[model samples]
Target chain A: MAEVMEKTALFEFLCRMGDNTLILGHRVSEWCGHAPVLEEDIALANTALDLIGQTQLWLEYAAEVEGKGRSADDLAFLRDVWDFRNVLMLELPNGDFGQTLMRQFLFDAWQVVMLGHLVRSSDTRVSEIAEKASKEVAYHLDRSRGTVIGLGDGTEESNARMQAALERLWPYVGEMFASDETDAAMLAAGVAPDPASLRAEFDAIVLPALAEATLTVPEGDFAHKGGRDGGMHTEHLGHILCTMQWLQRAYPGAKW
Target chain B: MVASVEQVWDWLDAVPDPEIPVISLVDLGIIRNVAWAGDTLQVTVTPTYSGCPATSIINLDIETALRDHGVEKIELKRQLSPAWTTDWLSDKGREKLEEYGIAPPQPAGGPERCPHCGSTAVEKLSQFGSTPCKAQWRCTECLEPFDYFKCI
Candidate 1:
C-alpha cells in the first residue's frame, strides 16, 4: 500500500511538470508567424518546440509510472482542461509580444531553478530527464532574461508595456511556489524539492533581471491557486485544447 | 557473415547527418553507443535538442543506412542521460561546419570569425536560427548571414 501511494504521488508530480510545459508550449507556438519581427517569430517557435519535446519525455514517464497502459499521446490529447495539472499563469492568453516575453521570463526563471534541484533527484529517471532538460532551460532563461531587460529599459513606451505585463503576471507567480501534499510526498521520498524551497533561488535569478530591466517586482503575494491541483483552470485552456486535440478527438486514432 | 563492431562503426561513419549533410552523424557526436546484442545491432542516439523535428528523420536515416549495409537486425535506442552537448562535436565536424559556410560554436557564446570571409567582425542576428540547434549570425565584413551551431 505504501509503495502504491508513492507511485501515485510520483505520477502526479510528473504530470505537473509535463502539463506546465505542454500548456506553455502550446501558448508559445501560437506566436509562430505572428511575432513582431522575423527573428522573434523563429525564436518563439523554437522555444515552443523545446517545451513540447520536454513534455513528451515527462508525460511518457508519467504514463509509465501510472502503469495504466496509457501512452503519452493519450495523456496529452485525450485529457480535458480539468485533468491538466499546469499552473494558472500558463493557460492565460498571450496579451501581447511584451506580455508573452514577460510570461516566458517569469516561467523560465522558475523552471531553470526547479530543474536544477531535480537534476540531483533520488529518482534516476527524474534526474536523467532533468539533466537533459536543464541545458535547454538554461538557454531559454538567458534569452528571456536579455529580452526582458532590453525592452524594459529601452524607451518610455516599451518600459511602460513591460511594467504592465509584470503586474498582470505577478499574482500567478505565487502559485508556482505554493506547497501541497504532493510536494510533501516528493520531499519525503527525496524524489524532488519542496516547491517553496525553490523561491530563494528563483528570486536570486529573477529579482535582479527585473531590476536590470527597470521593471517593478509588483506588490503583495496574493496567489490564485487550484490549477495545479486540477480543481480549476482559466477559460483559455479549453480553447487551447480544442484546437490542439481536434484531430485526435475527431478522428479517434488518427495518424500521419 | 557477422560484421565486426569496428566494421559497423566504419559503415555508420559514412552516414551523413540529415540536417547538416556536410557532416556525418558520428561527427555530430549523437551516436553514443553501438554493440551487438545477440543478433540485433543496438545503436544508441541522443538528440541535439529535445524537440528537434529532425530526430525522427535522423533515426530513419540511421536505420536505412544500416539496412543498406546488410545489417538486418538493427535497434535504435534514445538515451537522454549525460545529455548531448556542443562539446561532443568532433574537430572534423567543426571544420566541416565552417567550410560549409556555417560558423562553429564558440565558448565565448558567439562566433569567433565569419565562415564566409574569415573576418573577426561578426554580429548575432538572433539567438535562434532556422533549426533548433543553430542561431542566426552575420559577418560584418562580408555581410553574409550564416547559422551558428548554438552551444547547449
Candidate 2:
C-alpha cells in the first residue's frame, strides 16, 4: 500500500514537471511567424521546440513510473484540463511579445533553480533528466534575462509594458512555491526539494535580473493557488487543450 | 559473422550529421558507446538538445548506415546521463565547421573570428539560429552572416 502511494506521488510529481513544459511550450509556439521581427520569431520557435522536447522526456518518465501502460503522447493529448498539473501561469494567454517574454523570464528563473537542486535527486532518472535539462534551461534564462533587461530599460512605452506584464504575472508566481502533500512525499523520498525551499534561490536569480531591468518586483505575496495540486485551473487551459488535442481527439489514433 | 566494434566506429564515422552535413556523427561526439551483446549489436547515442528536431533523424541515419554496412541485429540506446556538451566536439569537426562558413563554438560565449573572412570582428545577430544547436552571428569585416555552434 505504501509502495503504491509512493508511486502515485511520483507520477503526480512528474506530471507537474511535464505539464508545465507542454503548456508553456504550446503558448510559446503560438508566437511563431507572428513575432514582431524575424529573429524574435525564430527565437520563440526554437524556445518552444526545446520546451516541447523536454516535455517528452519528462512525460515519458512519468508514464513509466505510473505503470499505467500510457505513453507520453496519451498523457499529453488525451488528458482533460482538470487532469493537468501545470501551474496556472503557464496556461494563461500570451498577452503580447513583452508579456510572453516576461512570463518566460519568471518561469526560467524558477526552473533554473529547481533543476539545479533536482540534479542532486536521489532518483537517478530524475537526476539524469535534470542534468540534461539544466544546460538548456541555462541558455533560456540567459536569453530571457537579457531580453527583459533590454526591453524594460529601453523606452518609456517599453518600460510601461514590461512593468505591466510583471504586475499581471506576479500573483501567479506564488503558486509555483506553494507546497503540499506531494512535495512532502518527494522531500521524504529524497526525490526532489520542497517547492517552498526553491523560493530563496529563485528570488536570488529573479530579483536581481528584474532590478537590472529597472522593473519593480511587485508588492505583496497574495498568491492564487490550486493549479499544481490539480484542484483548479484557469479557463484558458481547456482552450489550449482544445486546439492541442484536436487531431488526437478527432482521429482517435492519427499518425504521420 | 559479427563486425568488430572498431569497424562499426569506422562505418559510423562516414555517416554525416543530417543537419550540418559537413561533419560526421563521430565528429559531433554524440555516439557514446558501441558493443555486441551476444548476437545483437548495441549502439548508444546522446542527443545534443532534449528538444532538437534532428535527434530522430540522427538515430534513423545511424540505423540506416549500420544496416547498409550489413549489421542487421542492432539496438540503438538513448543515454541522457552526463548530458551532451559542445566541449566534446572534435577538433576536426571544428575545422570543418569553420571551412563550411560556420563559426565554431568558443569558450568566450561567442565566436572568436569570422569564418568568412577570418577577421576578429564579429557580432551576434540572435541567440538562436535555424536549428536548436546553433546561434546566428555575422562577420563585421565580410558583411556576411553565419551560424555558430552554441557552446552549451
Candidate 3:
C-alpha cells in the first residue's frame, strides 16, 4: 500500500473503533436514572463515561491523522449514518436489564481479548491507549460476566429473559470479527492486531462463562456486516446522533 | 537565585487532585519525572487512565504551579509506557484518601477494606463510583457506605 493509503486506512480503523465506543456509550448513558438499582445506575454511568472518554481520545487521534483540521467533537457530533463504522450490535436498543447486560457482556468479552492484542501493537500511541483501556475493560468484563451469570441462573423469568437477549444479540457477534481492506492495512502496518485471530479467544473466554451460568449460545448463521466500510448502520444510530450532535449542530462551534 | 528542583517538587506537593481533592497530584503518583531540559523545566506525567478527564487539567495545574514559583519555560510531557497504577500512590496519599471516607486502593487482586470503622466486612456497592478511579462500597459492620479507589 502507498503511504497515503496506509494513513487513510489507519484513520478509518480508528474511526471504526471510536464510533463503536461512542455509540455504545450513548446507549449505556440512557440507563443513568432508570437502572433497577442505585448501585447499577452509578456503575452503568461510570462505564458510559469511560467509553465516552475513550471516544474523545480515539476520535481526536483519528482527526489528527486525517489532517483535515477536524477536532474530536467535529468527528463525533457531526458525522452521519453512512459515515459511522460501529458494529450493529452496539446500536441496538437496550431492551430490558437482561438485554442490556447481554449486549454489554457480549461486547466486553470480545473487547478484553481484542485489547490484549492491541496492547502489544507496533504503534506506540495505539499500544499506550490500549494499555490504559485494557485495565478498565478487564473490570468491565468481570462486572458484566458476573451479572450475566447471576441473571442466567437466578430464576426462571431471568433465565428466559437472558436466553432471548442472547439469541437477539448473537448475530451481531459475527460482524465484530469480519475484517476489511482497512483492517488488513492496519494489520500489515503492525498498528493493529489481526481481529480475525481474536474470534477464537473471544469464544473461549465467553463460552465457559455462559456454560457456568447455564445459558446457551444461540446458533446464528445470519451474521450482519458493513459498518467497517462506513457504508451502513442500524436505524437506532440516527436517533442517537440526532440527540448527541444537537448542541454542536445548532451552535456550529459550541463549547462548554 | 534559581529555584532548586526540590522547590518545584514542593510546589507540586501542594497541588491537590481535581477529582479527589484530598490527595496531591504528586502523592497520587501521576508525576513520573521533573528535570531541567535546556533552560526549561520539563515535567513528565502519566494519566491514571487514557481517558481520564483530569489529564489536561492536571497538566495545566502542573504548569501553573511551577510558574507561580517563578519558573519560566515549562514543558509537560505525557508518558504512558509504564501505565499508572494504584501502587504508585504514596503512603501519605493513601492515608489522606482513607481519612476522606474514600478507601485507598490495595494491591491488585487484594481484598478491600472499609475506610470507615476499619472493618474487613465490606461489600462493593458498585464497581464504579463518582469518579472513574473509585468504586462504591458499603461496610456490613458499620453500615457506612463509602468510595473505594479501585486499583487500576
lDDT of 1: 0.94
Descending-DockQ candidate ranking: 2, 1, 3
Off by over 4 Å in 2: none
Q: Candidate 3 — what's its lDDT?
A: 0.86
**Global local distance difference test of model 2:** 0.94
What TM-score, over all chains together, does every model reach? 0.99, 0.99, 0.95
Task: Give the alpha carbon lDDT tens digit for every residue of A63-164 in model 3.
Answer: 999999998888998888899989999988999999999899999998888878888888888887788778888989999999999999999999999999
| Per-residue C-alpha lDDT of model 2 across residues A37-140, encoded as one tens digit per residue | 99999999999999999999999999999888999999999999889999999999999999999999999999999999999999999999999998999999
What is the CA-based DockQ of model 1? 0.91
Query: Model 3, which residues run further than 4 Å from truth?
Result: B108-112
lDDT per residue (tens digit) for residues A1-256 in model 1:
9888899999999999999999999999999999999999999999999999999999999999999999999999999988899999999999999999999999999999999999999999999999999999999999999999999999999999999999999999999998888999999999999999999999999999999999888889899898899988988889999999999999999988
Candidate 3 structure quality by residue, lDDT tens digits, B1-152: 67778888888999999998899999999999889877899889988866677888898888888888888899898787687888899999999998998888877543367777988998877887888888888899999989888887
Higher TM-score: candidate 2 or 3?
2
Q: What is the DockQ of each candidate?
A: 0.91, 0.92, 0.67
Model 1 alpha-carbon drift over 4 Å, by segment = none
| Ranking of all candidate structures by their lDDT, best first | 2, 1, 3
Measured with C-alpha atoms, the lDDT of residue B85 in candidate 3 is 89
